[model samples]
Target: MENIDKRNRLDEAPFQYRINKDQTVFIDYEGKQVKILKGKEAEKFIKNVNAAENDKAVQLIMAKITGNFKRGNERKKR
Candidate 1:
């Protein structure tokens, strides 16, 4: 398997998730809320996140879940 940590910088791990009391999951990117998952989807996401071996794995999971977050023409912030 490819090493995700190498492809993406550790400081650039922008994905974050929070589980609500109602069993819903809120996924965030760069401190912005991007996705909300509930029911079976939420459960599965939780399982996958919990099973992730490292931060990079979790970041990959969130990126896949959130679809394409980048547009080729966008410039990086300094």
Candidate 2:
């Protein structure tokens, strides 16, 4: 079997976040909302995201906030 280049898939960032006027943070994955942060948590999340050095860093932060997603048992959508 040939070695497949899976780096492209890892380069794709599926996580996104938005902050509301009331300082609530909304975390989304693949265009769907998954987590919400309010009050102190929202403030801390904003600070961390802003301090992230790159897209990959931001993705990592979002992934942790949204809980474990890389269990290796996820099936690819056809």
Candidate 3:
């Protein structure tokens, strides 16, 4: 499962967090270290992390990196 936190949900927050060789991320929320996975491991991480606010943060990050945030159905309307 992915680690989803309130910070991740913010659109103003940075998306490309540091990439450590150890594959662990240290988020300063919840007062504890957190782990963020990449590549195939990311799929599992998504399942574990689920905070509504955090989800929005992640989506914004993805949208910014991808240049847009329209869902499949919404894209079709454009």
Candidate 4:
């Protein structure tokens, strides 16, 4: 989890979401400018998110999490 700044007071504020003129989904989460989707990138993001919850994918992802998931070890070809 990320640490929230005290002065921002975003810990108590509700999130605000809006779409930009270019159809980009912008989120104001905890006083942070987080983008959820933009232009053609939404399709890929939605695909991965939906895949994460699939029955077969869930099992396979859990297997990796319990076995191969690690920190600072990305890009290690296997």
Misplaced by over 4 Å in model 4 are 1-13, 40-78
The 0-to-1 C-alpha lDDT of every candidate, in the order given, reads: 0.84, 0.79, 0.41, 0.44
> Which prediction has more favorable lDDT, 1 or 2?
1
With candidate 4 superimposed using the best TM-score fit, by how many Å does residue 8's alpha carbon deviate from the native? 21
- Structural similarity to truth (TM-score) of each candidate: 0.81, 0.79, 0.23, 0.30
Best by lDDT: 1
lDDT tens string, model 2, 1-78?
013224444257888888999999999887889999999999999999899897777877787788876566787667
Better of 1 and 4 by lDDT: 1
- Reference-based TM-score, model 3: 0.23
- The alpha-carbon lDDT assigned to residue 23 of candidate 4 equals 60
How do the residues 1-78 of candidate 4 rate in per-residue lDDT, one tens digit apiece? 023232432334434445567666554444555446665765443354367654444333222323332344545335
lDDT of 3 by residue, 1-78 (tens): 235343434444434433466654333222323335566555433433443256555544333433433243532213
Deviation in angstroms for 25 in model 1? 0.6
The Cα error of candidate 2 at residue 47, in Å, is: 0.3
For each of the candidates, the C-alpha root-mean-square deviation to the true structure, in angstroms, is 2.3, 5.2, 13.7, 13.9
> Lowest-lDDT window of 10 residues in candidate 1?
1-10
Q: Show pairs that collide, candidate 1.
A: none
